[model samples]
Target: MPPEDRSTPRARRPLRHLRAAWPVVVTFIRSWGLMALLVAGGLAIAYRFVAPPPPATLRIATGPGEDSAYSVAVARYAEALRGQGFAVELVASEGSVRNLELLRDRRVDFALVQGGVAEAGRGAGLVSLGSVFFEPAWVFLRRDAGIGRLPDARGRRVAIGPEGSGTRVLALALLEANAVPADAIIASPLAGAAAAAALLAGEVDAAVFVSATPGQGIGTLMRAPDRAMLVDFEERAGAYATLLPALTPVRLPRSGFSLPEDLPAEDIVMLAPAAALLAQADVHPQLVSLFIRILQAAHRGRQVFAPEGRFPSALNQDVPLHPDAARWYERGPTFLQSWLPFWVAVTVERLWVLIIPLVTLGLPLIRFAPPIYTWQMESRVLRYYDDLRRIEEEAAAARDRAARDAVEAKLKALDTKVATLGIPSGYGALLYALRRDIAFVRDAVRTLRRG
Candidate 1:
């Protein structure tokens, strides 16, 4: 690049006399130090507060609506999130296993995952908003099979669930606990409506339905034309719950599905695992908070298992809760959060951490910088004044003409230097005063010469 044209720019006269030894460094600090500090502080606060805006839309992995509670609940969450200016997109998947996979791969922002899908541990990089609802283990068998207990299905063909499903996981665990030989049962890969269809068609002797909420498939099985009987887990419900830390004991009241028709003959005891709202660890905190609020509005009611306002819970979650969700659960909302708009409140909360420290340090600097800069400029004038006084004293004591002439030469040199000294126009009075004193010394030296 060609050199910049300084020729036509405003001319700055050279300040040789008053230039300090470390002029560039000292001049820059004195001219722009405070402004640079203020600009940097403002930018720091902006980055902390506004860099991660709430996403306009988020994709969530939910299970097929025909058979999974996740589908139903996710739709409700989508509605709630939309009302708050967020677009919630639903991506249907196989089940909790696929949901976890989607979250880990970053294919989706959120997921409704069943507890205990974390065989070794919660999928890497995943965190939860909270447990939303219980997924009961519902087992159904042919009415004539007369199978009253879980162990009785040892030799009978059973449809666990499809590949990569939490239902398959729980079913295998339960049957294994009953000592049912894996080789003895015809475990099918069919899940959801397919599994229910297979059981009704007599392709499998029984089917196990594991879902966070009651889906159409479970309801279809119960109301099947062949009258398939729902196997009561009464005998082994507690045992299953005890063996599986994730499972909770639940009682499904008789005819809860159809009060007048009395769908089931008696109350059924079962073990169920709760489904949690999960996200990646690095998801924006503001988005997490917004997700929690949507979860709250969508889940603030009595589920088939839990009491009203008991869901969206932080405690006892299978995965660790997102930090923001935990804070919301522990302390409702912050002060500004309660009064101001959500974005405004969040921006303030995020900035205060940086803003508070800058304010604490900046006030002292603002008070002291100007005075220190003034003292530096004044020292230049004082040094010249001291030199002039020494020259005047020597001139007054000189007895010979040669000595007075040398002192006069020194006075003229000092006068020339004072004339060239540079300072802001505001200090013009001080500059003029020093020149007047130099003239006085010059006249005294001439008088000594004449004497």
Candidate 2:
């Protein structure tokens, strides 16, 4: 090389040392290697800090057509979710049982299911977002039929609603409480306006209607003044539970059914149950939390069906609260109704935040940590070189068997130390080779002493 272009030997001295020690540098890099990997992981986790996607399109399962309170509830939920940028689809269902079945099958994302119908095998994958409403049991009888409690209508024709409905389940329980034989009663499985029509037209002497309090059809009937009589269930509550364990005893205040004149003075004994929202166990925690906030918002102030704020409480339902819902309760009441958009954002981003530190600091360290640790471990074995030199000098001038044996034992002990140090799983062969080299040197020293 030309003198002008060439680096002087003195100047290149640092380069030569660096080149010689490149392997040592690489070894150090391998040790504590986890630090670099952990930093990278941390960066990857941090990259997930973007804003969440817009509110999703959801499907809510509601009862019947547009006439039922189930349908009315759907409208209310849709309106609220829409304000939060969610597009909610309302699927028409037969009633609570069908709503719960849809939720179990993943056919709909949400539903309003009455409490009593879900007894034995029906409630595996469901979760209550919270109670949306209480479905009051309204049993109307013909004026002259004189049916006070449920048992009096055993021989008479009755409409309890179609199959797989909350009304049918409750009606069966009411009759069983009265000791009315299932075969003795003429049970008609009709629903909504059809059940009402059957009772008014005298095709059925009594009809059981399960709907929100002051329900439209029952409200219309109550307006007719003495045309039909409401069954008073106050006296027979314990008897009611003995027959149907799931039936909750409640009261419809005198003003609930009365418009122009008070019907009954004090609290009247009535039977009712809450409708719950349920979902699969594996449903995403964020979605579960989001749905709860929306539900609480939809029914914030006054109760649409039961007493104000009483419908959504935890004590009202037959099923246990979803874990996600339980967590929200732990954090105190939800404020999403007042600051919806903010809370929605908060809910979605919370999970990502929790995972951030682990990815950034924990995971990267896990990946890079092993190689770095191996290098440090290898250095401990490498330390035998200095001790071996010192022993070789002492063995050359050994005067007796005792001195020779002492030097040999020291070398043997060092060999064992090197042998016992654990190596990585993939480096087992390398460790064996290192131990074999140490043994070969020790054997060479022993042969020299014999000579």
Candidate 3:
């Protein structure tokens, strides 16, 4: 204390002292650039792998008339598609045969066609949305006439549908099964209101009406008491198969016709094939998914023809499914469809799903990067001196016990804090060297105290 040491201990400023640590600066710059490159590369790859949304409108070919099943179905389907921002156009065709023809020509995006008619025309370009209902072969015979099977009508006058109609295709196949000579069976080419009026007026001996009930033509006839009898197919199941391989024996249960009055005496077995929603193979996947969702939802409550909750099944059918339709039905539809969002949300979701890959791939990299960024920033810090050097400097330069004690406490705190910091496992040697130096300095300080 004789001459208070003019030199006083001062806090070390690592940042100011080592501002030009070029190696650490270069490492930091390299790491930041590499992280950016990794993020961008990952995002670009994800964008390429992502799937896009389908087109906005679907052009569907319905039936010849709005009264027909295909027309009815497409109309209802259009309503469901509104939420998806899809506009459906219902195009007119002569019948199922013409529907298949337009489909072959790629004239339409989707069509509803009778099952067996599309068999011979089957190619890679078609896919099924599911059977909407049974397109039954309805044989309306005069109430007084005694006939049961197709063979009974061999020599009798009959009304088959017009040339290209689905009715004609089904009628010929059925009549031929009964071994009726095409020339002998008097064929009347009539349909719809004309056919229904003809049968009521008794112009034709029998009318072959193919429709869903309360079908426009058939239902009109059914409402008339004893005008025509629905011919049962229980006896001709084997014959139906021989003529039309696609035919399956279905039952018009007595109660199904009229729940209260019970028009049918008993369950009547009848031949049937499923009507399918056929689409071109090239139809986009998102559209196919959207179409199936709408079609399935539309037919959900209909249990009269196809099984309830089973109308949109991808079961037996002639046309192959559009690849997109197959993909959607295979995995089943999404929550958006089942949940039925509003138009705005549905549109946003369709777009959102497309961008999902970008977000999924990008988010993890973004969330995982902050700690890495902080480490990269701090990597440039200059290394702190070992505690022994700091303590020695303090003892040599410190003027009073208070200053010496304060420096000793600060050194101890620095040592404790550094020890707790998680450095690389290989840095144990550096820690051991620091501890050894600290012990040596403490011993030297104690030895000098006895002086």
lDDT of each: 0.77, 0.70, 0.69
Candidate 2 ranges with C-alpha deviation above 4 Å: 1-38, 42-55, 261-267, 304-306, 333-451
Off by over 4 Å in 3: 1-34, 143-148, 181-184, 223-227, 255-262, 265-267, 321-451
RMSD of 3: 9.5
lDDT of 2 by residue, 1-451 (tens): 0123245568886775566456555665665554765666665666577445434778889887687877887788788777766778888888887887888888888788887766676877666777776677888888867776576887989898887687887787778777886787898997767777777777888888887656566765665546677677777777776666666777777665674566544456667777777766666566666677667766655763455666456656567688768867667435553355644655646545646676657665776677566656566556666777787777777788788888889888877665545444455666666667667767866886786
**lDDT at position 69, candidate 3:** 75
Clash counts per candidate, in order, are 0, 12, 6
Order of the predicted models by lDDT, top scorer first: 1, 2, 3
TM-score of each: 0.71, 0.64, 0.66
Question: Residue 152 CA error for candidate 3 (Å)?
Answer: 3.7
Query: After aligning candidate 2 to the native by TM-score, how far in Å is the CA of 254 from where it should be?
Result: 2.7
What is the lDDT for 136 in model 1?
87
Candidate 2 or 1, higher lDDT = 1
Candidate 3 TM-score, C-alpha based: 0.66
Clashes of 2: 12
Residue range 1-451, candidate 1, lDDT tens digits: 1233466434432332235235434754874596567757765765665445667888988785544578878888888777777777888898888898899889999998888886477576788888888888888887666666778887888888877788888888888888886776878877667878887887888889897566666878878736587777777667777777888878888887678878655787778888898898888887777777777877878888888998888855777788878898998866887788777877776666666556665666666677766766677677898899899898888989988888988998888777655566666788778888888888877876776
Q: Clashing residue pairs in candidate 1, if any?
A: none
